[model samples]
Target: MDEVLTCENSRVKFFPIMMYAMVMGMSGLTIMYQKAALWLGFTDMIGHLLMMVSTTLFVVISLIYLSKYIKYTPMVKKEFSHPIRLNFFAAISISMLMLAIIYKEVNVNVASMFWYTGTVLHFYLTMYTISFWINNNQELDHSNPAWFIPVVGNVLVPVGGVGFASQGVLMYFFSCGIFFWVILFAILLNRIIFHHQLAVKFMPTMFILIAPPAVGFLAYYKMYGVIDVFATMLFNLALFFTLLVAFMYKNFIKIKFFISWWAFVFPLAAMSISAMLMYHETKDVILLSLSYVMVGVTTMVISVVMYQTVSHVLKGEICVQE
Candidate 1:
């Protein structure tokens, strides 16, 4: 048991592990304002308060991890080539984009700045990740839903880009994201079905499969102001995937708690938020009820994970490499 814990501890570096917290915290805020606003009723005071808390937490965490990265250059470099670690860059981009979305109503100038910065950074990161895929001799057997991270960033661009960018620009990013989602989805699905079984630690990331479509649905609605057929398809697929993964809850429970469990949070939050948006468009009580249930589930899950993470940190069980 000691050896196993030690081995797992060694893999927990600063670059990406903290991103789990950043994404979850930000997603909570997004759900509170963007989706929850529909059912909970929005107020400027509450919106600003939630935004400030989530954004402050994200900025502080980013600084802490970045400082650690600079101080431990050797370790950072070593982890750069790691397939899973590479996805951390995407988390950074996505966090920035989330900030853009949150800030859009609060401060357009700041929101625009974050939107552009995140879009550009995500574009570069997507290229880098794809280049790594092509240049490295790594086998597709290692491919997992995490690969969707960078690609999904493209789909997410329109979520904030709709407000700050031209329709043409939003389409460019949206098209790119949707295009990559199709390719990566097929590859990842094939791998999961026929390739090697994912290790227990990575099982949580399977929830990532739910994100692109959920996010895409939200992005589409933002851009087009309607839940057209394409948008409906995206939400439906996300819903189906959510149910599919929920059936595998036993698999996730059997695994030990890790920071990667945060992977489950944002996707679930996205689905909840998507359902909320769907309720607004369709005025369907069923969709509204589903949104409420999802909100409860997402909150409970993140709360538990956050508590466990803090407990682990206090016990000195995290962020130490073997």
Candidate 2:
């Protein structure tokens, strides 16, 4: 009886991890399809397909995890279930906008805004849900150092996710929210630095959470000159910051492994490419292109690093996933 109970407990414990992997894998597929659409110039059709896939994934994952794995806080229970409802609304909006984009049948600006707004709604809901869980339940046991690594690291995921998705709306607000978000991120970083001895300063996973939203912001900045001056400056500063962090990691950690490193490189490259695209529109071609080239090289190196880490884990070697 005790053995059976232990087995059941193990299965329950693994559920969240499995859910995380599944959701993240779906995200990767969405990104891959988006890239494919861009390269193929079948943006109208493929973009719609990607949007559909993303919408489906978001709804399915949210329902499955929230219904089963989530242990809600009083705040979540009391506060209106706005996040969940908003996600459902956004999924619907995305489906409609995707159809419009495919048919080229709607007012361009309206369609663009729908896409932007829907994305923001989706990720903001995600961040809120994840944060509620983290604050309420996940951090109750701080004695486990291994848990802190992923938990703290993943907090950035929510932050980045929100920032990335809201970039379009953020630019309209003249980068107002973005400035505050960055400040908040810095504060969080300082807390992690002081409280946690983990040297995440050079960890590639940081970019995994950082780059996507930065790219989103850049995408909007390039698409519309909403806040070019501010966004450009911010992006360049981010690149410098990334380089500095990478340098520090190289100097201190002798990172001889790589399992989840690809996560970092993809987002970093997304930001770099977005920045270059924005700069190209502004005629700052040379520097931006150079930045993109440098980012591409670093991306490949990090991919190799991630591959090594994954290989080690599979062989029952390093237990980095914990």
Q: lDDT by residue for model 2 over 2-81, one digit each (tens)?
A: 22122232233322222232223234334433443453233556445655654464455455435434543332243324
Model 2, which residues run further than 4 Å from truth?
1-180, 192-196, 199-202, 208-213, 251-263, 283-285, 288-292, 309-313, 316-322
Best by lDDT: 1
lDDT comparing candidate 1 with the true structure: 0.77
All models: lDDT?
A: 0.77, 0.41
lDDT of 2: 0.41
| lDDT (Cα, tens digit) per residue for candidate 1, span 174-213 | 8888898899889887887888888777788898889889
In order, how many clashes per candidate? Answer: 1, 6
After superposing candidate 1 on the true structure, give the runs of residues whose Cα lies further than 4 Å from its correct spot.
1-21, 42-49
